[model samples]
Target chain A: MLRLFKNKFFLLLLITVFIFILMGVTAKQNSKLNWFSNTINVIFSPVEKFFSGIGDKIGSGLSYFGDVKEVKKENAKLKSDIDKLEKDTADLERYKQENDRLREALNLKNQFNQYDSIGGNVIAKDPGNWFDIFTVDAGTKDGVGNNYPVIAGSGLVGRVLNAGFISSKIMTIIDVDSTVSGMLTKTGDQVIIKGDLSLKEQGLCRMDYIPTDEDISVGDSVVTSGIGGYYPKGIFIGKIKEIRQTNNEFTRYAIIEPVVDFKRLEEVFILKNKNVGNTGTDGAGK
Target chain B: MKARNIVFAVSIFIIVVLQTTVLHYIKIFGITPNIMVVVVIGIALLFGNTQGAIAGFILGFCQDITFGKMLGFYALAGLYLGLVVGIVNKRLYRENILVIIFFTFISTIVYELSVYLVHEWGMHLFSPENSNNLDILYAVRNITLPEAIYNSIISVPIYALMIRINDRFENANKSIRKY
Candidate 1:
């Protein structure tokens, strides 16, 4: 039996089968294997700090280039003119649709003013191709907790999947296994946006369970429904890119392109939603 | 043995730190000039295979920690590359800087290619939905020729630097032997 198994063909086949089994078992339970993640992060913090120094230099260099006399003068003049126009427009359209969105956010803030907002920069991205997790500079020290909603100016970034002493890992909305109840901005049709993390283009999230008869159209905007308790209502989620009614389900599904450009994510606000439930499924995939 | 091992460990620590941090800033197409690769190749040329494999695995693990990618990906790749280079070292008599640079370049590709193949294979069997249809062949195309050429160009000076460091160790060893 030993000699029979010693054949190169058999050995290769055995190894191949073993590796396949291993990958399958591992991927299925990868969330449970969060043992080394913190240790790895701790070891790599110095490296991240080093790169941050270089980032500062590059940022300063760009700022210096922008401060050239010709460019600076032009920018200042453009800014003043735009400021004047913005002030006039603000007064004329103070109660119009433009202010409505801001007002809604202000009202939401007033309602949930108990939790302080902590701002942090996205430090490093997950080095692997599959994991859509990124690290932020602030953590427990700044009162950041697991499940805190992270958002950029455009829309939802993700939620704090895990938090460390001085850093936190955000599992972005683009990650696989992520789901958010979203409403069509124009028609108010409710659908759940499912993150297809397997896709290469990160912004792709699918709107599922929409009735086939719903008046959903291409280019319709989607926003959080606020039913999930994780996100505030009317926050932009994405725009419908495609709609398909397959035989597998009664509801038509549409792919959404997220409003946030996750690739270039820098700074973000961590919103402390009081209604977020105690879902034990924090950072380690639990 | 203790002092020499410490020196090797220190050198590897410095190389891995520099590779992920400073060199990352100058990255072109995610291919940073890997000084750790040059160091392992240099050691294989000088001290042979067993030591080479050990060094490669250790440094590769350090790299995995810094990169924060799927764990053990680079470690396994480096181990295989080190063994192959060690086997080739037995039949080769060339040790010029340019020749070493070429060896480093080829080994760097080997290391990267091995990791890429592993990742592709992992994704295919684990998550078919995420798998790219072309597999390794597609990954090879994405790497492009220019990135490899850039790695080769940077490998020359970095390889020279490692050789100098090795020479200093050898000189110190010889003086200690006399004492």
Candidate 2:
């Protein structure tokens, strides 16, 4: 035992194991915890700015020609009202969809005005493959709390995992630990959605305990059932990505593609309401 | 020694910020090379296990802190990688650039694999429903291995610089002894 101390290899391993054990024990409690994660975000802000500059340069270069072409194209298209009307119809259709989504979201938002909502940009991604989470610019000072739902234009992102003064970390919908109660929007069949962080960029979530007899087609949409205290009902979750139905299995499962585009995720709204019920209007409405 | 140590710490801090926010742009096939991991391995080879482990722990800790992960995951992974590399280095001649390159190549894989395993197992325990559906091999190929390889290549120049620093320190010590 004395000689083992001399081996730095063994010593390092021992220390790591001890730390792991200690972390496991206190994982539940909110100790001093680590502020270094938040500190790193602040330190890395300049780096993000540098990249954003490069992105702007590249974007401007590519769009310069398109900008010139677009002016002429806009004039030509404006000359023909019939063609212009068709284009306007398509645009109007898209706008209607957008309007409806926002309308639903606004209705949901009105239910929880008691709690403040913080708007923040996603500053960084989950560092490595070990976790499927994200770091955002909102924190405790922003009124964001643990398990606060984050939403984009589409629907759900995840919930607040760790929050600071100016920023908070979100465990994305792709993370394995996240479980959102959702239902088939067309059929009203309740199911539990789990995140596949492994396939995060694909925006995949898994649905379990789905009845075999249910009419769950490939394109059937999923939405939060509001059974879970965190996410309010009627928020669009995703379309069914894939289905794996085994003969022996009693309950079928399907992979869902989240409505939010994870790759282009930037600014998101951090919802402060954990209790979706106590809020004024029922989210599931006519 | 103190000045050199401080330089290592400062350089690593700068590199990590660049690695996460800047180098993320250099992604090829969904894996952005991990510059910090390679740097840790390079430093470990030059300074031996104690310094190597220290560097690894700090760098990995920095990654975890910045990325908002479960604390100490990267730190422990890095510490072990550095120790293993440092210990094996005693029996091998790492003076050649090819040797350093090879070291980086192998160590990166080791580092990534360790992290991935911990992640899967941890997720399995924390959320079993999410764990059963993952394509582990695809995840590694798309996101893990390529980044490791890219970082390994990047570490070649960095390891050469580390060797140069070591040489300068040894030369200074020799001059002092002669005086």
Candidate 3:
């Protein structure tokens, strides 16, 4: 039996079978991946970071070189735009103070109150292109953990799948395995927003199980319902692009066009779990 | 342990990094050709099974951490991909572009089928959102076929580079022997 196992073909077959079963075992949702099993991420984080930095520079620098005069003109326009934004910022600040005073007077919590987040630059991506899994430079070392919500300027990007000591993998909203509890902002009608590979090319998702009678339609805003303890309520998910009636029991689905531009994604903010009680709200640094 | 081994390992690392980083920005018709697959097949064909298996196993394991929902999902598929592709070792000339194209096309088909099968199986075992939604035929038509065609076109250059690498190392070894 030992000799039989020693044969290469037999050994390969055994190993393959073992891994196939192991795949099922490991397929279920887990909180954190062991760092020991994922030392490769640790080993390659810096190199990936360096290359990503260069890639970002190259992408931007090329456009700058194409037309220096255009950049100069844009620079002048941006400077004036910044001056205008400064005025807008001051007005918004005054409103924020007034709003805060009213909330405090009424003893009401700020509806815009959200968890504190630490930002990280996207260093590497999942080699396979079908799904939008990627890695970030931040990790447990940077106060991020598994299931922490990842976001960009426009909206929800994804959540941390697992955290290594120095790096973590993020499963984007459009990954086929990702399912988030979602509801329409306009109608409050709930639906399950999950990743579908077919629609992933367009950076879109399939929102399923909508009621036939539900008045859901194109352009409805979807956000996290916070039904699942994983993601907090009201994180902007995406807007519906198209709706289709499925033959399944629930019968209706919609396509979500994510607000985050996943194709050009370079940096992301990972929100700390809100229940931890340190809602500092400073999320715009490194 | 040898310099050639070091070169081979570094090549894998570089290819992986390139696949994830630069390749993310490069897509045609929203399909990104998997360069790692082509590289692994080329390595397996050139280097034979033990090296091929080890390379495939490590690459697959890393890929699991990268893209898989579970730990060993991509690892098992990658391991088998290398092993199966390695079986046709040294039979075809390394320099032949036609051989690279044929092997990449076939290997990609096999790889995609395995992904679909394992994905469906896993969804069956561990409850997917709607297990009925895991359609294998739909995946093949939409995802696999286009990727296979793209990889076949992309494999030619990677295999050519692999051939160049093999030649360079062999020549260096010959020079050392002469000394």
Clashing pairs in 2: A37-B65, A137-A167, A138-A167, A138-A168, A139-A167, A140-A164
TM-score, candidate 3, is: 0.85
Q: If ranked by TM-score, best first, what sequence of candidates would result?
A: 3, 2, 1
Tell me the TM-score for chain B of model 1. 0.83
Any runs in candidate 2 off by more than 4 Å, and if so which?
A1-10, A29-31, A35-115, A246-251, A274-286, B126-130, B133-136, B164-179
lDDT string for model 3 (A58-121, tens) is 7888887888778789899999999999999999999989967854664434433557778888
What's the fnat for candidate 2, on a 0 to 1 scale? Answer: 0.29
Reference-based lDDT, residue B101, model 3: 88
Which candidate ranks first by DockQ, i.e. highest? 3
Worst 10 residues of 3 chain B by lDDT: B125-134
State which docking tier applies to candidate 2.
acceptable
* TM-score per candidate, chains pooled: 0.68, 0.81, 0.85
Model 1 residue B130 lDDT? 46
Model 3: residue B77 alpha-carbon error in angstroms: 1.4
